[model samples]
Target: MENLKDEQQNHHQPVKIDLSGSSFWAKKGLKSLEANGARVDVYWDFRQAKFSNFPEPSSGFYVSLVSQNATILTIGDLKNEALKRTKKNPSATEAALVSKQEHVHGKRVFYTRTAFGGGESRQENEVVIETSLSGPSDPEMWITVDGVPAIRIMNLNWRFRGNEVVTVSDGVSLEIFWDVHDWLFETSGSSSGLFVFKPKAGFESKSLSFNGRYGDGEGEDHDVEDDDSSPKYCHVLYAVKV
Candidate 1:
C-alpha cells in the first residue's frame, strides 16, 4: 500500500511483500501437479483471505500468500486507515480488481472499491482471465470477488500438518475440510469468529433466474471482531446450494 502506482508489488511496511521472481512462498508439492499439466507460479494470490484482528481496532494484522515453506506476498492492513474501507490492488493480488461493479468473475476478481484514493479511479469490470488451481484434490480455499468466482486452492493436505486448518482447491471447483475440533465446541465467545469472508452459494452458475442474487458488500461486515481470544462471539457461514 506504500506506493499504489509502483510497477513492482512491494509494500515496504512492517508487513512486507516479495516481488522477486523466486517468491518466499513454497510450491514444492505443487510440482507433481505441474508434471501432470497444471500451471505454476512463484506466488499465489489468496482469494478472500482473512487476518486475525490486532488488539487495537484500528491497528490491523496481515495475511500472506505462503506455501508450505515460504512467504510470497503479504498485504499490509487490508483496510484503508483514512476511510475505513478495504484495500485493493490488481497487480499485487494478481487479480483484475474493479470498483463499484458486481461479480467480476475469473481472474478479474474485484478487491474493495477505492473509497478514499486520489481520483475516482476504479478498474474496469469487463475483462476476464483464465486462472485456476490444481484438480483432483481437496480444497484449500474458496474465494470470490464480489459475487464472481476467483481463485481456489486444492490438494492442500493439512490434515496431518495439525494446525486447525483445512484448505483444498482444483482450479475449477473447491472443497474445504475443517478440523476446528479445538477452535469450536471447546471454545466460546468469538471462538469461531477468527475468519471474515461470508460464503453463500447460488442455485447454479447457468440459471441466473434461479441462482439467487448476490448483493453488494453482502458479507463485508461479517464476524466484526477486534481480537481472536478471550471474547464472546460466534461465526456463522450462510451457504445456500442448489
Candidate 2:
C-alpha cells in the first residue's frame, strides 16, 4: 500500500521541465497570413508537447467553427510558440466532460467523453484534419483541414516512443513527420507542429498547410507559398525559434 501511494503521488506531481529545452511549434507562413485578415495561425504537436500539473490534461489543438479561429492546446510550456490557454472549470451539472481513463505512467489517466455535437446540417464548407493526438474523445485539439477516411498511422505513435507523423488528405495526402524522440524523453528540447487541411471535396481546390519551424534564426520573417509559381500566398508558414 505504501508503494502504491508513492506511485500515486508521483503521478500527480508537477512535471519539472527545463523551460529552456521545451518542445513547441511555430510554423513558417504567419507573415503572409497575418497580412490577410487579422489571421492567427498556431501549430502544436502534442505527441511531444508536455502538460504540467493536471491529471490527464487534454493537450492538442482546437478550433471554433463560428469564428474560424484555431489554436493548439498544451499544459502551458513552450519556448517559442504563442500559448493559447483556456481553463475550464465545469461544475458537475453543466459537465460537458465525461470520464475515460488511460494508463501512461503506471497510474490511470482520465479523459473527457465528448460527442462533437451536430450542426443543423452539414456546413456549406467543412474541413477535417486527423492529428492522431490520441486524446480523450472530447478532443481538446481540433483544427480545420480535410481528408476522406482513415489512413494507416504506423509512423505516428511509433510504439509510444514519441516518433509521430500526422497526415491530412484532400485525397491528396500531405504528411508531417514530427521528428523527435530525444526531446520527448531526454531533456527539455522542443518539437514542431504541422497543420494541414483542404476544403471539402470539390468545394475548393486549395489546401492549407502550417509548418511550425524552429531552430537558429528562428524569428526572421519568412514567406511560404504553394509549390506553383506566382507567389500566390495560399498557405501560411509560421516558424518560431525557441
Candidate 3:
C-alpha cells in the first residue's frame, strides 16, 4: 500500500505489509503501525489475491486500516471479511480516495479499471486508451469506457493537448484531459502521454485547474486553501510507449 494517511496529513513513504504466502509475519494476520501520528491496525488476507498486469491485486483479498476503533480505509472486494476480522464499524468520516497516479507501459493500447460515482451507486468501468502514433494514416487516439468509445481524437499532432467531457454511465460523467506533446515532439524514444480523468460533478469548482502537465515540471503551481473541501477523486495516468 502507498501513502496511508489520516485526516490531518499525508504520508510520503509507502508501507509494505506482506499478507500473502506462508511466511511467519504473514501468518500473524494483523499488523499494527502508526501513520500521520495515528494508530493504524492493518488486517489483510491476500492468499487468494488475483492480479493482472498491475502490481495491485484485482480481487479475492481485503486490506483494512482501522484507527480509533473505526475502519477508515478498506481495499479489495472483501469488505465484509475485512470488517469481520477487524471487528470495527465503518468510520463515519471514512478516508476517501482523493487521487490515483498510475504509470502504464504499452506500445499502442493501455488498459485500466476505475470506479465512478460514490457510495452504493459506485461502479467500476474498464478504461482503455489506444493510440496510433506512427501509421500510414494520420495519428489518432481513442478512449473507451466499458467497451463504449467515450472520446476519439483525430489528427492528434495538432490537437495533442485538449479536454473533453464524456458520459460514463447513466448519471456519472467524466471530464477528460490529455497532453501528448511529449509523444509527438520528443525525438528521444522515451515519450509518455498524460491523461487526467476527473468526475464532472462539483470537481471543477472544488479542485484547482490542471496546468496541462504532470509530476514535477515547469508549470504555475496552484494551491488549494481548504484541504477538507477539495475534490476527493481524480485519476492521472502516464502512458509510456515502449
Candidate 4:
C-alpha cells in the first residue's frame, strides 16, 4: 500500500482510489457545507476524476469551500473540452441547458439536465465556481451521477435528492445516499428500504473497513463490468458540527 505521504504528493495523477461515489460527494460537498458556516475552499483532481472503469470519460461531482458560506464547484468533465461545444453553439437538441442553480450554503450550484445521443438521457456536468478557493483532499464519493449500471446503499441514514436509488451490477454494487443529516453505524438489511445514516463524533476519521472488497492497486478489477444497469445514484449532503 502506498503511504499517505505518497498519496498526497501525487494526488493529481490518476491513482487507483477505492472511494465510493457518495463518499466523494460528501467530501467535496463539505466545501459548500463549510461555506455556510465559515471560510472554505476546494479543489478536485480533474485528470483523475475523469478516469473511470466505464466508457472513456469519467463522470462525477466534487465541491470546495471558499468561506464560511461560500463554495466553489465543478463536476467531472463539466469544464473539460467536451462542453466547449455547448458554449459556442447553444442548441436545445445539441446542447444542454442549466437544470437549476440553487444557493447551497451561499454558493450557487448549477445543475444541467442534458441528453446525449438519441434516447440516452443523462445529466451533464454542473459548475458552481470559477477558480478554486480551497485546496484538495481525497474524494468522499466518486460514482457517476448519470452514467453507471448500479450502486447499492446498504445503510443510509441521511436524506437525499436527485436520482435516489441503487442499481445492481454484475460483480459489484454501489450505494449513493446521504445519512440524511446524520451518521450511519451498525445497520444492515434489505436492499429495498430507506436506511438512515446516524451521526457519530469521529465517524469520518474512523478508518474505513471495506472488508475484503478493497485492493491496493496490486491488480484488482474495480471497474463497472456492465452498462444499462442503473443510471442515477443520488445523495444529499448536510453539515453537522463535531
Instruction: Give the number of the best model, judged by lDDT.
Output: 3
For model 2, where is the 10-residue window of minimal lDDT? Answer: 90-99
Task: Give the poorly placed runs of model 3, Cα more than 4 Å off.
Answer: 1-43, 48-60, 64-92, 202-231
Give the candidate number with the greatest TM-score: 3
Model 4 misplacement above 4 A: 1-38, 41-74, 80-169, 173-193, 196-242
Q: Candidate 2: misplaced stretches above 4 Å?
A: 1-147, 150-152, 157-191, 196-231, 234-242
Distance from true location, Cα of 157 in model 2, Å: 6.2
Model 1, which residues run further than 4 Å from truth?
Answer: 1-143, 149-185, 193-242
lDDT, candidate 1, equals 0.26
Kindly list the per-residue Cα lDDT of model 4 for residues 1-242, writing each as its tens digit: 00111233542212112233564553223322242355443444434355433332455533221333322222344444323322222111221221111112222121222221112244233211111112353112223334442332222222222123332222222232322111223123211111111112121221222233322223422222122233222222222212
**Count of steric clashes across candidates, in order:** 20, 24, 0, 46
The CA lDDT at 5 in model 4 is 18
Per residue, candidate 2 scores C-alpha lDDT tens digits across 100-205 of 1111111112121111111222122233323334354321222333333423334343522111123333232232222223222333543333222211212223
lDDT of each: 0.26, 0.25, 0.69, 0.26
Report the C-alpha lDDT of model 3 over 16-86, residue by residue, as the tens digit: 34343453256226777787799988787878888864456677887787888877777778888787788
Model 1 lowest lDDT segment of ten: 202-211
Candidate 4 local lDDT, residue 74: 29
Report lDDT (Cα) of residue 135, candidate 3.
67
Global lDDT for candidate 4?
0.26
